[model samples]
Target: MAEISREYMEQVAQMWNARGKGLITHMALEIENVSSEGVRVRMPFNPDFCVDKDQTLLHGGILTALLDSVFGLANFVTIKGISSMATLDLRVDYLRAARSRADVIVNAHCFRKTRHIAFNAGNIWFDGHEDAEIARGTASFALTRGDTSLLEAMTKGKAS
Candidate 1:
């Protein structure tokens, strides 16, 4: 793969984070950085969050959303732009619970992607820069030949 410019990658990542273009808002899901290599995203514990009642700890489902979003974004970056790739499967194993008292970080990346499957890995961190490795897994995404609901969703999400 050709080297991608950092500026360009950031632009695309920002575009992906747009409220209209994505379900994961940048403010809600802080995608602090993104490159051809990986993406670093942060999500703070909000008592208002619909998932869990604990104000300090993040919900596993929220972590899963973070995982899914980062993985999908990373894979989209690997394509150098948007494509018809759709997540066929995603499996995550949660090791330790996130630190109850602080914000959490999700660092994710795609190793390589083929015509169909995209391999990815990442970890969750709490109250530190080092990955806590709270979870890690691979995703199988199939590249669609033409317009599918994924693309339509992307389009609609962006249009708003």
Candidate 2:
């Protein structure tokens, strides 16, 4: 494989929470560090992110999405600095309820990859420590090989 470029990574990382330019953006999810096998993502706490029935705690589904996306991103990072993979199996374990005031940092690593499958692992912590593991996850995905390219994937069959 060729060497991965910083431009490639920054462009791809921006895509992590970009649904489009104006409609939705997770600009709050900042990438602190990146390597070929792993990445670290940080999200600032906001009172608007409550999860319990009373909306006082962090929600499980949001945690799942954050962990899953980071793990899946590790898989894509192994590729040609582009993404053509989606999760097929995602299993998450909630170790403890997290605080809405707790800032989250998700660490995910690309452990292994086969010809068609990628394996990844992730840990979510509110305070970025082993003792703060509010959740942990393991996931698998099937990589899709293609020639159409991401540009087409982004603009095809959509209004200009």
Candidate 3:
């Protein structure tokens, strides 16, 4: 893995948090760890994401969305000079019922990257239960590389 500067990581965190009024913002994700190798994020238990009246069992759609979002973050950290990226393909598997009130933890990494594409994989589980993953996902992203990065485009409102 390449060494990622702390300054760059902080910028990424700030950009992620600054995303206003969207599913990502509604998810209220927190970055726990970040590096060229991967990223770990935590999503606090949200009753709004639950389908059941009890709010203990999490909806599968939420897990899928979480994985997709984290996979994008993983690609952003690992791939350089990307002006924009879009999900080309996504596959998710529900390993088991997500029936916990505990926060959800997701770890994702970009395993492959080329000039125009990146591949990512990740797994999610309730906090403190690493042995039991509730969901796993893999995705491919179409990347557009340019002098201005996605971070710059987002933070500065620069056209890619």
Best by lDDT: 3
Regions of candidate 1 where Cα sits further than 4 Å from its true position: 20-23, 49-54, 129-131, 145-160
Tell me the spans in candidate 2 whose CA falls farther than 4 Å from its real position: 18-27, 53-55, 81-83, 128-130, 151-160
Candidate 2 lDDT by residue in tens digits, 85-112 = 7788989999987864767889998788
Ranking of all candidate structures by their lDDT, best first: 3, 2, 1
- Encode model 3's per-residue lDDT on 1-160: one tens digit a residue: 3677967876786676676348999999999988877899999999999989999999999999999899988888667788889999999999999999999999999999998889999999999999999999999999998888888878776567
Candidate 1 lDDT tens digits, 1-160: 5888888677666666763233475327777888877998887666654344656555677777778878887876556434466678888887876546667778889887775677788777775746456666667676654344333446466321
Per-residue lDDT, model 1, residue 89, is 84
TM-score winner between candidates 2 and 3: 3
* Candidate 1 global TM-score: 0.78
**Distance from true location, Cα of 76 in model 2, Å:** 2.4
Whole-structure CA lDDT of model 2: 0.71
Candidate 2's TM-score reads 0.78
Of candidates 3 and 2, the better by lDDT: 3
